[model samples]
Target chain A: MLRDITLGQYYQTDSLLHRLDSRVKLTATLLFIISLFLVNNLWGYVMAAAFLAVCIRLSHVPFRYMVKGMRTILFLLLFALVFNLFLTPGTPVVRLWKLTVTKEGIRMAAQIAVRLVLLIIGSSLMTLTTTPNHLTDGLESLMKPLKKLRVPVHEVAMMMSIALRFIPILMEETDKIMKAQIARGADFESGNLIQRAKAMVPLLVPLFIAAFRRANDLALAMEARCYRGGEGRTKMKPLVYQRRDYMAYAVLLLYFAAVIVIGRILPI
Target chain B: MALKLEHVTYIYGADTQLPVRALDDICLEIPDGQFIGLIGHTGSGKSTLVQHLNGLIRPSQGRITWNGRDIWEAGFPKKELRSSVGLVFQYPEHQLFEADVFSDVCFGPNNLGLPREEVQKRARRALELVGIPEALYGQSPFELSGGQKRRAAIAGVLAMEPKILVLDEPTAGLDPKGRDEILGQIAGLKKETGISVVLVSHSMEDVANYVERIVVMSQGHILFDGEPRQVFRHKRELEEVGLAVPQVTDILHRLSAAGFAVDTDATTVPEARDTILKALGGKWDGPAAGRGAMGEKEKC
Candidate 1:
């Protein structure tokens, strides 16, 4: 029943997007999110949607998968829609019980819902395509400028990578523990709120204990393998910007510029 | 009631890429009141197989019928099914979280929406089944020794009044005495309840001692399913699948191969000794011979 979560989950595929240098893809995703917020009109939103559609098509990632990712934040989208639908206060089209639907408000709600869905899908696309290791590598390299300020960028990235790597391991462990407890007749489903939470105690206690044990083992293993915190460490697959990378970056920049120009003209 | 799997196939993450076919076209029947051993190497689908019986996992293809009814059929409440097929997992003591032992054991029956008195009765009976003293019921479960806690956790499952009990390597990572105690408790529980028992284990000797039926799995497929002796007869097949026959049987096979008239099919040391002695014209010796036999069994 805990299988619905897809946050930071990578989908394995042999596609162009999956093969792209992680650093380039990471930068492009961030740029896309920024450009999404740059839109001020319906036409600008249309352009952004079209751009995302083309990217999804080119990446060979199934459109249905992206839609599934959007489903996770469906509640948030609906909440935004409801909040904006009645609270914006403009030319009311209908009056309901203590609520009024307005043209401007409905339009704003639609825009916000679309924007949020696109934003989530676009950023999640990057994580879905890239492995956690490569994602962290990209993050570490991108944050290299902050090294001058002694921000421990490498350490931060390393921690993030480790956390991401441990997620699936912990999930597997939790599954095993849950089954064990279930075999012991620990009923998690079909209970009152408090009973259900109490049911989880049997699953959670062992999980926490195991997590601590794993943390200890991982630390010792890292030390035994002489992991010295990324100091002077060389990557086996160093990042290289090729001609395709440059072209991709140029195309993204041009798209952002065109969207900004169109937004200014339409300015809803 | 015999639990039947009609061509059950289970695939994990089927809606996404990297789908794992954990169980592939498995079909078998586990009859009532039999101690069944499920043996497989790591990633051999043994875990997936047991999860199906208790309805912890649903098959992607095929149905698991208990008492001739589809477990996943509409209107089949999974909670009742789970109670019927109690499962005790390896290192089960770790899942104990209640402040006291009685409350921890009561978790199962209470979830079944039983009356408070029934819950308390089942809890006390379950604690008794696992041989826990009534005095210990009020103490924190966490404060108990590891073996006692493990027994208490297992008793929690028994409290559900399951008709069939499944244990996945219940003795793993425990001291020898702890292992023996858990196994002994299971034997007692089976006798007392007349419930079918399914044991998934890595040890062949444990299976030999406990289970009447054996099912061997490898690479997500059922390799063998029969009586314990029948399944273990194909020593070569078992070896190829990364499993072993009981060591006593192996020793007997060696003795028989060396021109002794010993029975290689003997699954226990005492059985092998009796077989060997009979082959030697019933020339049975006293304490020294018994000690030697014990030593040989230990070596095996």
Candidate 2:
């Protein structure tokens, strides 16, 4: 039961996108997010959706895993549908018991849902190919220029990397703790709302304690390893922007231009 | 009575392309009221195998029977099954959260939905069984020392009154003295309560000294299941699976190889000593050795 929770966790695979420089992929994801928001028409959305589909294929990530990521946003999808369905004023499609379901409201809700689903899928695809370490390394490399402003970009990246690495460890720890409590007859499944919340006290208290202990130990170990923020530190695998990265960036620029032109010519 | 797994197979993400076979056709009968040791390296499926005993994990492919009844067959109360087969996981102290030790230990009996008076009684008995004194009852479990926290955690499980207590790496990270105390407590509890004990450990000495039966697992398969002496006899086979024989047995084997005439099957220090003496062609009090040692002691 514990294993079934979809964490948007990446599956290891060898593909064109997987082999690309992580910096390029990170930049592409940012561009893709921007492109998703830039789409104002149904045709633009269709183009964006096709782009995401091609990216997913290039990454060799299963479509099922992408849908798993969308599962977390299911509630938001329904909420958006309801809010748009009722709140937005439009030409009524049907009237039922003081409620009017409008054609424009339905179209807007569908568009919003499509946007959200696409956003989750696109982001998940990026994460699915690029490991958290590589992602952070890319971020650090991308943010290097911010060092002139004393932004401490490397420190942030390091912290993110560490947090990503510890996520699975902490999850495994939590699972073990839950099992231990269950062994002692802590019923987390049954009971009313208040009773269920009360049961979580047993699980949460220990989880917090374990998490703090882990943090302390990790800090001590890092200090012992001479980790002093990200200052004066050299990476083992230094990031280098290659010619292929430049080519990829150029392709994205061309795609953005194409999208702008297509939006004007084929307005929804 | 026995806990039996009949060709049980469990897979994680079985429908996915990258399905992980956690347990593969595992079939074994764990006898009643016996101290059995499970040894395996990490990811060898030892944890998955034990999780089935209590129905914490249901097998994807075969059956689990307790005393000749299929546990997975409809309408089996899995919660009741779990209570009957207690599992004390590694670092179990992390499970403690109640304001006081008593309340925490009572959590189990309370979950069984027993009468309040009966729950308190079981809590007291379980605490005593784990050697946590009544004086420490009102104290917060979080404030206790590491070893005490571990004892308190074990008491929580003991409070459930399980017929079979399964502990995974119970003595891990404890000092030798603390390890012995906890291991000794579990052994004593088994003897007193007549409950079957399954101790999962990587330490060969702990298992060799405490358990009557040793079960070796490798790559999601039960490699061997037998008495300590019987399992250690196949030293080559065990080593091939990245497991070592008990230290005393290893030392005895080394002694025998060096022409000391010690029996390699000797699993304990005292047994090894006796074997060494027999190999040296000498009695406990040899005629020349006893006289010389006595004369030396008198001169001293």
Candidate 3:
């Protein structure tokens, strides 16, 4: 059951988005998220939805794969929906048992829900198309300017890539530990909250120890290989923006401008 | 108790873009008190097959039966199945988590909800069974050496008193001496207890030495299942699947190929040594008497 997690998981497929520059994709994702907030009216959301649909189609990633990420934050989405639907101060449309539903509240809730869903799908698309190595390289290159300000950009990127690489390894380890415990007749299911939490001790203690041991071994191996914290490093496959990346930026700019114009001119 | 798998198949990440068929149509019967070696290269589904024996993961296709009853059927008592078919995973030492060695061993029996005294008794006996000293029982498992930690981990599963013990690459990553010591203890336990053992390993020599039956797997299919000598006789076939025969068996085969009057059926060192010595004895008499008749007859 633990295998179902696909967060930060890269889908290997050759497509336009997959071939584009990681820095371009990363910057586009950030800009898209910013524009999502700038959107206010129905036409703005319509334009955003159209752009997302086209992007998803062009990327060739299965729609369900992107939707799966939304499941993890379903509760947060529902909470925001409820808050906007019930608490927004506007004209009340329906009242029952000390609860009021306003027309404006309905509009606000729909807008918030769309915004959250689009935000999740947009980010998931970026991760799905790009491998973790490329993602880290992209992040490090984007953050290179921070080095002038004495920020440890390389170290941070190294740490991120390491963490990303270890996620699946640690997950597999957890699954093994859980099975070993199960073989010994430890019941993880069919327990109350506290009982279940208590049962996790056997699993967690060993996992933490294994994780630390792995980290220690990795550190020693790195030191043995003369790793000196990302200094004097060269990339095997350096990132460079291609013509397609500029084309993608042009499309993104057109979409962003359309959303801004719609948000300004459209009546609420 | 006998464990029977009928047409069992397992597919990892089923319904995903790229599903992997880890086990396909695997049919085998593991009767009680038999020591069977399951040998396969990496990604050969040896671990997946062992996990199915105890119902840790249900079969994606077929049924697993214990004593003529489907284990996944309603009211199969999964906890009892798990305890009865204990699996010692690879690098099991990483699973040891209790404060002390004794308590950690006790965890399995404790999970069985047995009486405290019974749990303690089983824990102590298991520790002793694995040759862990009494003085080290109170020490934290984390403080033990690598080999000791591995033994403690094995003891944890042994405390459950399984009818069929399944170990997946139990001796991996240990020094030669440590590997032999652990394998020796496991063989000894099987002999003393008369419980069926499914030892999942890739080392041909180790399996050839201890297990009576060898099951060779490749690409989720059981390629060969027979006596160690019988399986090793198909040296070319085994090698084709990226598995080698026992070193002694290989040596014997080479000797036979070199036109020596030697028995190539020996799977163990002692058997190969005796075979080679018998051939040498015959050759010594042949050369002394200046007659090749005796040696030729022996070869035939």
Number of the top-ranking candidate, with DockQ as the measure: 3
Task: Tell me the spans in candidate 2 whose CA falls farther than 4 Å from its real position.
Answer: B15-17, B258-262, B283-300
TM-score of chain A of each: 0.94, 0.94, 0.96
* Native interface contacts kept by each candidate, as a fraction: 0.69, 0.77, 0.88
lDDT of candidate 1 over B268-299, digit per residue (tens): 76777678778877666574767586766565
In model 1, the Cα lDDT at residue B202 comes to 78
lDDT of 3 at A21: 90
Candidate 3 on B119-192: residue-level lDDT in tens? 99999989988999999999999999999999999999999999999999999999978988999999999999
Ranking by TM-score: 3, 2, 1
Q: What is the interface RMSD of candidate 1, in Å?
A: 2.5
Runs in model 3 lying further than 4 Å from the true structure? B282-300
Instruction: Give the CA lDDT, 0 to 100, for residue B56 in model 3.
Output: 88
**Candidate 2 accuracy as TM-score:** 0.93
Q: State the displacement of the C-alpha of residue A205, model 2, in Å, after optimal TM-score superposition.
A: 0.8
* lDDT agreement with native, every candidate: 0.84, 0.84, 0.89
How do the residues A1-268 of candidate 3 rate in per-residue lDDT, one tens digit apiece? 6765655788877889899899989988998898899978888888888888888898888888777767788999999999899998889999967889999999999999999999888888899899999999999999999999999999999999999999989998999999999988988997999999999999999999889989999999999999887678988999888888899889888877888889767887
